[model samples]
Target chain A: MRNVFGKIINTKMLYEYVSLQRLLFLLSLCLSCLYALAGFTIVATLNYIGEDIYGYLFLIFGICFLLTGISSIKINKKKSVRILIFSLILFLIVFVSTAYPSSVGLQDYGLSASLTYNMIFSIGLIIFGLIGALLSLGALFNFKPLGNQYGAYFLLVVCMLIILYPLVIIIGQVTINGAPGITWEFLTSDVRGLGESGGILPAIVGTLLLMFIMFVIAVPLGIGAAIYLEEYAGGHFMVRVIKMAVSILRGVPSIVFGLFALAFFVPIFGISFLTGGLVLSFYALPMIIRSSAEALKSIPQGLREGSLALGATKWQTIRRVVLPPSLPGIITGVVLGIGEAAGETAPLLFVSTLIIKMPPNLLGMVASLPTHLYTLFGMRGGLGDEVEVAARMQNAWSTALILLTIILILNVVALVIREKFRKEF
Target chain B: MKKKLSKEHIIQGIFLLIASFSIFIIFFIFFFLFKEAIPAFIEVGGDIFSTDFSNELGLGGAIRGSLIVTGGALLIAYPLGIGGGIFLSEVASVWIRRILKPIIEVLAGIPSVVYGFIGAIILVPFLTDSFRMISGFSLLAGGLIIGVMTLPIIISISDDSLKSVPREIKEASLALGATPWQTIKKVTFPAASSGIFAGATLGVGKALGETMAVLMVVSAITRAPDSWFDIFESGPVLTSLIAGHWGEAYGLKVNVLFAAGVFLFIIVSVMSIISEIMQYRIEKKFKGG
Candidate 1:
């Protein structure tokens, strides 16, 4: 390979080949470098058009430049070279933008777009900075492919979990702050008013009630769907359509489902936790059906045949033979459903609104973890709002943590059940 | 045939009816969304795509922003997810795999709000200063955060698909003198590609659907892209529009938000449909028991 490259470089015909390869590589590098030129144009255009060209052009162009730079990172995945190139590109943007400002003497402390320009310009720099650092490291040493792949993969998962860290922090913050504040008065009291005067007793009770009602509403129906799909229904048009619909439901935003439920079911039932439960039921039922169907499908066919051969009725076979084995998955589905139900906010938004004081009865107003977060966050700039928001955000986090733990525990149970009913090919 | 169905048939039909209702419910959601959105779209000057807040332009900026953010995040996520999934399904020692699997599972349930908070508190500032950039909030923060959010979706689905790769195929590859890695590369990936692709679609779908994290982190600007590099800039995503602007926006403005929402709904619905088809193909590939 070296001899080939060497000969290709030195020889007449092959010299062109070598130069062409080098040219392509150089062109790619240059393209990355020139990417920041867009930022320059935006800045220049801003200066040329006058400082009051307030169409958010600075921010828009800055973003475009950053994207070009990011796309340029893939130009060379060989490591160090990419980093150097990315840095050069980023420097070009910053240099060009700053130079345009200097050449035109345009300095206004980034108040042009309420600091949007500064934020966008900085984001562009960060993109380049990350690429530069990683690419530089990648350049300095010949990073082994698998080793790098492993490292990248590690970062991806850790990053993903850490993405949830904000919620967890809020949870921790809330638990430490709000959990302690949960006196009997707090528990029983209504949100009579804001700021240190009211308790969350009604809210808690309402939340628990919603959970209970949703479970009651969703679980049975969901299981029935699962059972019907697994054991009874043939591959009929209706069955297939139903299955597809369920899959789509799995995609529908929980908020939309809440809206639909509010529109379709709430009026018929009234503005109670029942409405919340009904909405959540629509949301949770699909999951239950899907998961339980999966569990049912997983049960060995031989067991069903065995039961049938022994004169067991289909119901008896499913209940006595299949149901026992599939219980774990069913339970897992239920637990997962609860976890989802507890975390949901959008669907509950219209179905349930914040009541300052708790509901007078079961049919009265309600609030859950999501609603609580929204309440705390959306209190229209109330007093001590910063600390108050922080405290409430913390409560939201703690509630989320509690919700997550419940789901995790349930998943553990499900896995154990899946293992117990382990099917072999 | 008896007029009354058999006990098994009767019970099953009931179950099926119950199971089937979920699809109807989902349909109802689409109906409601469209109903509100359509009237609202008309109410909001009837423009199919307009983000003209302060006379900005068609949600062109948002579309571009979401694509960049989601795309960049996917660029980071897909390989890591599939590769890690490959390792989980094939290479890792049992103990390591045992430990890692549970983490992926747990990671899946961590809420979007948590993910947002993390990105805002930790990732946003670290990225901003470390890069010596302008502000903590940008497309980069949203992408990185979303990349994390989408990982479990990709990993779990990819893992499931990769594991579904037949043992006989593996044995055949070994018999043909291929090493484990080579077998995984040459044989398993091809077979599992459908599942892996489906997982990728799911990941993208989830990233697109994610609101709170994106809302907390991404810049909520409404302007046209002046250059291709806007991928680094934080801007509104479709769902984020609903949450961010719903308060101040009423009348046609709210309807415009719904129109943007319609785009999101279509994207997700179409994605699920395609993936469902792909999943069916994968199952068909496995053939009869």
Candidate 2:
């Protein structure tokens, strides 16, 4: 066989003779076909298996492999041959390691065990199969089979799809399941019949109230911190310390905030809206400081200098010039922070009550959306009457839908505001 | 004019006080957690590091569980997220980037409880049916859900890092006749290593500290796994231990949960410090350039 970079061999001279690339490609293709066949057999025979779906998959893959292998034999490029060989070896190793089954019996291990084994084996096959396919397609890039740059763009499209497919699936599932539960009554009524019949009224009110309290407490403090770090502190040592502190605070787990609140705040303030909001404010404070600081920092130095040259004092320039442009950014930050505080469950678990009734006062324990959803889906252990479980599931989906919608809207508003201000400056 | 000057002074003073409040709160957290945890520290002594879950007060199992979940989550998240980030920064068009960026932000914005809810309703059942495990809740389920939860953080940070790699270096590599992939692997990735590491550190802190989703999907079994790396088995992580027991915990149990919180706080703090340093270096590099 010629070297990988060698000129293409004349097809007429090599009808019987296979180059190294063709041989390796054919071998890998055959192995993958066998793997797919095995999957088809198992999937078809399993009692709960979805028809002979895998059988058809195996047939289609087998045909593709044979066709590719035949086409590869006629080509004689050296670089294509090298990549094909490497991909084959990698695929062979993956197939061998993953498809080999253990000696555990079906009876002893149970159906789930075998099902897991098959699922993993199938996944390995599919991954290796794709890698081999992509490697073969790499030849097209070398040959310029398609227009120049098309191959590159094709790979980019594939990568983009790979990232997007999972997100699409999750969003689709949530929307389909949750949309039914969202109604006017669902939005406005108190939860009743143990979350089976009542609307999510109390949870909605509680979530909004908690967000309001958190906004009241966190915005001023966060904006102050940002102003200090950005405009006042410069490169001072204390600024560095505060920056470090903010990063650490940001990294602290939401659950830890809950634990801290339970240990420190509950004893002082008791389990109420105040405690929940305070804990959530702590959870959101670092985010607010960081985003607001970024917004403040992005203001051009020329603007500040321009104000100074106009005989305005530093405070006057900041108040009149800097703060105006940066207000939108700060509001964006605050809105995002409130969105975060609204979704947090762990921090509020100790401070917020699961009471379905409306909170009588700020200090009264209140039902918030996230904690309420957690109670319905998580605290139940998923073991109950079938009807009850189904009802709870519907409620959980609706609650999740509402929560997701609120967050996405907040994020969209923030994005729009940031982009608008960003373009203006 | 004197009164106006004093007014400005007063406003600045108020802002300074407000800015300093967070630092005070941090100190307060440390003091309070330590004060509550000291008793458990004394009780468990070296046993706190044990992986044995049989002991009611020993935190070893919880610690091990936290490590397993965090490590498992990173194993799943790092490659996919980094790859996605690379694609977003290097391969995607401006339009694609614009569309995908907000999707990531939306992913990040989705509440943790919703993630847990999805896991409880969807992922748990799938795991049970696919694996035929008696209980659907397992370390694997928790890891998968938390991995998804952390993906936005990893992708956003890594994308920023990759974007920060100077355009000239990429052009230089291309000029040298390297393939786009080759240039990315050799030049762009190396240039962005510090930032990527910072992103991974941040991801690790997130996975380690995640509570609600893991609690919802993984059975809060406060036991060491049947094996050291049994992702199929149920276990209790540090965060879950606190979340599960805190409501009903009394006396030593409460202190132990606080002790676990302190342990988690320290780990997260170290990660936060490392990421902060890396970020500072990146900022300095850009400023100098």
Candidate 3:
């Protein structure tokens, strides 16, 4: 690849020419992929053979991990023995855990696999850790060293895969579970209760309304603040203080903000969509202010001077020239804030009062998807059948996916506007 | 020519006035918490801090947990976020940039709740297996999850900062016969440090303020970590403090949760202010701001 940058290098030579970094990165990726595949195969083979065989396989790997400590110690140095001890202890625990009798008295995991999955899941984890330790020791001892970048790439990509596993599962499971329920009827209808398989239409309505109103409350205030700091209140103590305040607001936990809404806002304004919107507006502020300020700052002063030379008023230049250019940045901030607002569950908890029947105008109690999902999963023994709950869960994912999609669209729009301003100007 | 006072100026003034009132809203948040929180302080008594109460309200332990978890998350998140940002800005090919941008978008767009739900279902089990049974839901798991959550913010902002680095500096470094990495390490990174640090502090803030996911993923224990390496032990952060204790406590105890909230607010505010000041100093020093 590097050779391609030079015209002197032959095209055929490119096949033979690979950097040590790239080669090492590739090898690490393959090794990790193989290790993961092997773990998966083990799980599959165990699952296929049933409990008795699975238990024995656990016993084998368990002993392998545990016994390596002593034999290795005898053969190798004290350092190896230490590694052996750690690795031994690690696998022994996994083995002991896997060897434990099934919950609910010697049962085959059929239907509702949360417990079974959680219990059996320990084996894969042990294997991964063991491999990681082994690889680290190998790397430490390797005559041929992988450079830092290669090593970093390997670790980063592997960790990312691990993090994305659940997301992959949710995206898979939800679409499979909820695709059938996403009828026009389901999207537009109302959910009466647990038994009703009615669509989350009302929930969607409530979410959109909440997002729109939150945007309404947040954007102008946030933009004004950005303007104050960026254009008006430059290098002032109060401006600096306000900027600090916005950053602080960024870190204020949503749940506490939820509590804030409950303890403060509801008493002042009463439980309603308005309160949820207000709370969400707080969640939106920091990102909006930060991004908007960045946007305003991005507009070159030369453009302002050019406009002023044409006898444009300062306010006119700001409105016609600066605003046109900064609009994309403002929109980026707005979209990001919307994305944050859409996911908020805690604040809505306080603001929505309790379990809402439906929206009672602007001030009525309502349920958003995150809060509804929280109730379904977090609140035990509350919802309908697994199928129904699964359906609702799917709906929540779809709603989130939909929300994400909109943000994506908005982001593209912002990018276009920014790029247009950057180039066309 | 400047416009005289008119309806539009008045409207704009009103808008600015309302926006400025956001400061009052913040003050209100602090004031309300302080008002509600005094009862709890009175209940706990000022003397409580003079002696360690090994089995008391666990407030001290909760603070320790917050520091450990939030700090741990930053430690792990910082290198990846900052390094990746540098790579994207300086080293990466156009194709890599194209791929990375949307991936980050997906990452940045994913809701914290979904991240929590995923953490609860997948990561908890994965950690339980990977670590020992007892270690899965520990502070390490919480820290790791928060690290992932904070990555997009750090990456995006640091990338912005790095791209903001002057072309002249890079050319100057290369002119001195420095490697690309050397230029990045010595010139670009140092120049961009304040902005990158600001991004990091924001990541820490996100990690600290994160509730639903950390609340679900971490074991809800309120114990001070014995050592820095004892991150694998279950513990509570300040964000988790209210959720962890609010249900059990009544009256002044609930007020105690508010006090914790005040503490959280103070922490978040202080860190952000530090980052901003760092940024200002750097800009003023280097760019002649």
Candidate 3 regions exceeding 4 Å error are A1-181, A353-360, A380-425, B1-19, B46-58, B132-137, B219-235, B244-249
Which digits, one per residue and each the tens of the lDDT, describe model 2 over residues A376-418?
7753545567787788778878887887777888898999998
lDDT of 3 by residue, A150-226 (tens): 44444445544443443455456555544554667656666645524565556667778888887788888888788
Model 2: per-residue lDDT, tens digit, B118-229? 7777778777766766778888888888888888888888899999888988999999877677777789988887889976898999999999998888867777675656
* iRMSD values, candidates in order: 5.7, 3.5, 6.5
Q: Give candidate 2 misplaced runs (Cα > 4 Å).
A: A1-63, A77-117, A143-162, A379-386, B1-9, B286-289
Per residue, candidate 1 scores C-alpha lDDT tens digits across B37-56 of: 77655544534454455353
RMSD of each: 10.5, 5.0, 8.2
Please report, as a residue range, the 10-residue window in candidate 2 chain B with the lowest summed lDDT. Answer: B47-56
Between prediction 1 and prediction 3, the one with superior DockQ is 3
DockQ of 1: 0.22
TM-score of each: 0.72, 0.87, 0.75
Docking quality class, candidate 1: incorrect
Taking chain B only, the TM-score of every model is: 0.91, 0.93, 0.88
DockQ of each: 0.22, 0.57, 0.26
